[model samples]
Target: MSQQPKSSDDENQTEMYIRVKRNKTTYFLQCLPSEKVLQIKEKLQVLIDEPVNNQRLILIQTGEVLDDSKSLADQKVENDAAVALTLRKADNEFEDVNVVKPDDYIRDGDGGSNW
Candidate 1:
């Protein structure tokens, strides 16, 4: 007799990750498609020490600013997607997207004289 594979909990089954970038940093966060943008910001708050009110998430592909009240799926944020993270400045303005690509990194072995 043939048997089907066992399934884990629904939460684990629908788990996915997204790469959130800010400057030279990237955070890999595990989230569900149904999760709201605010939820994702809360997770970032713990890691970045920034309050959700001061945080902003933008989709890198389309330059769309994510609404905190909407779910990831509702905004078409699929798994393995890249999102830009911006923060509110003291002037109460959200900073521009500032993600740095790998090619932007300065190499140390540029053959400069140590002396």
Candidate 2:
């Protein structure tokens, strides 16, 4: 009987461990090497407080941002890979409530202090 050659997928489907560093915390996750980055992000959303959309996962070894369309295998994310997590700032988040500006010093055309 003839046997078919094994595909790379077969070789890469093995489960692996990935470490995530976020917010001064380290999280360890078990996952398949072939799992999509989106899937990993979904899981991360569950484990971490941040939403997936706001989270940026960086493969520490490769220094590449994990894309939603690519799989860990495609990124060559090996077993025990370390991923760094960065949170995307929302438009309103962390805004300076009282920012000083040069314009603030200038008075309006109206002499009455346009406070």
Candidate 3:
């Protein structure tokens, strides 16, 4: 009787070591078996000292944003998987109040000052 070959699980459990790069620094993230992508983001937030909402993490191979619902295992993150995290530029950090100074209003083409 011939014995069946060992399953993938039995042969070797694959591990994912995610590396997140921000600015000039790189943070290493070691994920547990079956860990989700969102979890990795959370870990990166702690290491990078940035808000989780402001980060844009993508799979280098697929170019897809890491979805919270998707597991790292499903993403096929192996030991060599290269994950990159970019800090998304914040929109309009300075508010446009449209404050018209009294001097500037007089310089305008509108004859509001004379009226």
Using lDDT as the measure, the top candidate is 1
Cα lDDT tens digits, model 2, 1-115, are 9956879758746679998876447788899877888888899899876777877788877778889889888898889988887777767343222223446566767664654
Q: Write the per-residue lDDT of candidate 3 for residues 1-115, one digit (tens) a residue.
A: 9966868664444455776654445667777647777777788778777776766677767766677667776766667566667665557242221223346446567667653
Clash number for each model: 0, 0, 0
Give model 1's clash tally. Answer: 0
lDDT, residue 11, model 1: 43
Question: For each candidate, C-alpha RMSD in Å?
Answer: 5.2, 15.4, 16.5
- Candidates ranked by TM-score: 1, 2, 3
Better of 1 and 3 by lDDT: 1
lDDT of 3 at 82: 62
Global lDDT of each candidate: 0.91, 0.76, 0.64
By TM-score, the best candidate is 1
Give the TM-score of each candidate: 0.81, 0.67, 0.59
* Candidate 1 residue lDDT tens string, 1-55: 9955645644434778999999989999999998999999999999999999999
List where candidate 2 sits over 4 angstroms from the true fold.
1-10, 92-115
Instruction: Candidate 2: give the clashing pairs.
Output: none
